[model samples]
Target: MPIAATPLRVLQVTDLHLKTQPGSRVWGVDVDAGLSAVLARIRERHPVVDFILVTGDLVGDEPDAYERVRQALEPLGAPVHCLPGNHDFPAALGQRLRDGLVRWQRHVIVGNWQFVLLDSSFPGTPSGHLAPSELGLLDTALAMHPELHAMVCLHHNPIPTDTPWLDTMTVGNGEALFAVLDRYPQVRAVVWGHIHAEFSARRGDIHLLATPATCVQFKPGTAEPQVDELPPGYRWFELHPDGRLETGVERVEPARMPASARRAPT
Candidate 1:
């Protein structure tokens, strides 16, 4: 197999919690303003991105927000992949995003890497689970792409965050998900969003990453929904053809704020 000529850089932005209009607040943070700033920072910091993975919580249960999401994100000029979060209106989101700018894709193969997007969301709840079909899809995708390094993306954290309250909302079938992944050595990483903070763990060679939300971040290791002082942020991953990975989290600095918090038309 030919090695990729260049490393693949992916941007992961999550827990947008967008409202139907701009300047709306979630946990006291302007999410619309937050997302826009994160995107602008992404553009300025990393001019070239291979693909973007939004790990759920795209909206605050508003289907109307998906259109605004498309508009806010389209300027990045890269293929965007979305997964549903517990707060999303899945049906309306699918209908509204059927056209162009942003998209909902499950599996993608790029630059010797297989990117698998999972739907761990369960309607009307904050917990997550993988239906039998989704598990099968993962198995099949890995079987088909044994030649490519695999990175799994989903909405819920699959491992314990050591905080009792947040751990209750972890993927209900995380053990099952890991069972499938353990069978495939090509799987290198699993990433997600929802806890609204940064977390990293490792099991041998596999990396487990939980990114901070684009809006208000939760106080890490807290027992409840306490917002933290961390600025709005996004995660970047550089996947080398040799299966080595480099990633980091970046937040829009208050000094170099990308956009004003003033209301913009949704």
Candidate 2:
């Protein structure tokens, strides 16, 4: 009998919020330091991933920081595919992250799995919206590769996170996105970032996942935005050839910080 194929290992790091200046703090946590710690853990725990997906928020509203974002991710030694979050400048990402291991790739096929990265960012606002063209891309990719299992990724949550403040920023036309996905049975999962907290749910047979930010986490189920004391982290996945997937979140202890750097909920 023939042996089964080895599962493909993939890493996802999102919501870096890196600024032009190093050591900047987001919500009292050092964003750069947090990302470095998460990357170190990734190197130790997932040293040989097939690729890395940075869902969005690579920089903190600073277009010039794309280069810094590129520098931070280069040492990982895997093809890094990135999409824009509300805080990102799309043009800058395309121009600065064009070469090397980092790229602005929308669709990727590996083994029997096809990854579709979408830009849910709407201009001049933090809320998410999928344009007609983006939906078209998904339709086209799924139609062309019916045999390949699909995992759709975006920076914004497609479902209500139950956090009232955060829900205002969820994908505005998420229903349309689901309507498209409903047509394809091969879509195994839909994953995203921007919530800064880990979320897991099931939509029929499809898996819905939201990963924590590498910088800081927001407390879930709160009326207002509140910071969670949970340490920074990333998500990992093992995609088997038969459409079976094993995934989990790994949080790392952030470097010790001065008391002044820690923020308290208002």
Candidate 3:
């Protein structure tokens, strides 16, 4: 495959879990602060981020958290496309980002790649299921962009993490999801957020990647839902025009919090 004039650069920041309030803590870490630190590292290291893929859990259940998320991401100066996680309120999130710099869009094309974002969030449930509409979108998008390398993004993992408890939440209809992709040779990657850690694997010609959360990190390949002691992190991707790509996970230390600011909620 010949290289295009420019490689598409993307930063995947997921499971932000930002609280409506700045100093709120989750699992003993100040998540809002953690997310800020991750963004700082991205800005300093990757000065020219073409796009940011926010895979969901942007907040807990706060209706106002979307606005806060939008505010925090404004400094990145890149278009952000978001998908909903089980913890997110899509309608509320859409309202805040509907007409802003952080809007959630379905299909985006950069260089020789076509990005298709899908909503896999199932209301009132931790497990995910891709609705038929999403399935149709995936089918149509791949059909429409046969000449472009396609990367499909969703909030839930389509393949099991193999970490017993976490696997329970993998996309319930993952087989169905795969069936759609199996027909499209143009699909090169499947990316998601939810497991809260980095995962990289391949299925045939497709890359399966899960990015680390911008907040607390989750211990991988465990029997249960476990929080790792690692600091906050994010993933970066460099897509070449020749259907080849490079990606890596980067973690940043949390900013120093005052003693009083370090307490977890009761």
Q: Give each model a TM-score.
A: 0.93, 0.95, 0.93
Tell me which residue pairs clash in candidate 2.
none
**17-130 per-residue lDDT for model 3 (tens digits):** 888888777666777888888988988999997799999988876778888889999889988888788888889877777876788788888878999999998888888999
RMSD to native for every prediction?
4.2, 3.1, 3.6
For each candidate, the alpha-carbon lDDT, in order, equals 0.84, 0.89, 0.84
Query: Counting only residues 3 or more apart in sequence or on different chains, how many pairs clash (N, Cα, C under 3 Å) in candidate 2?
Result: 0
Say which prediction, candidate 1 or candidate 2, comes out ahead on lDDT: 2
Per-residue lDDT tens digits for candidate 2, residues 95-210, read 99887899888998888899999999989989999999999999999999898889999999999989998988999999999999999999999999999999999999899999
Backbone Cα, N, C clashes tallied per candidate? 0, 0, 0
Ordered list by lDDT, greatest first: 2, 3, 1
Shift in Å, residue 242, candidate 3: 0.9
lDDT of 2 at 65: 90
Candidate 3's clash total is 0
Model 2 root-mean-square deviation: 3.1
Best by lDDT: 2
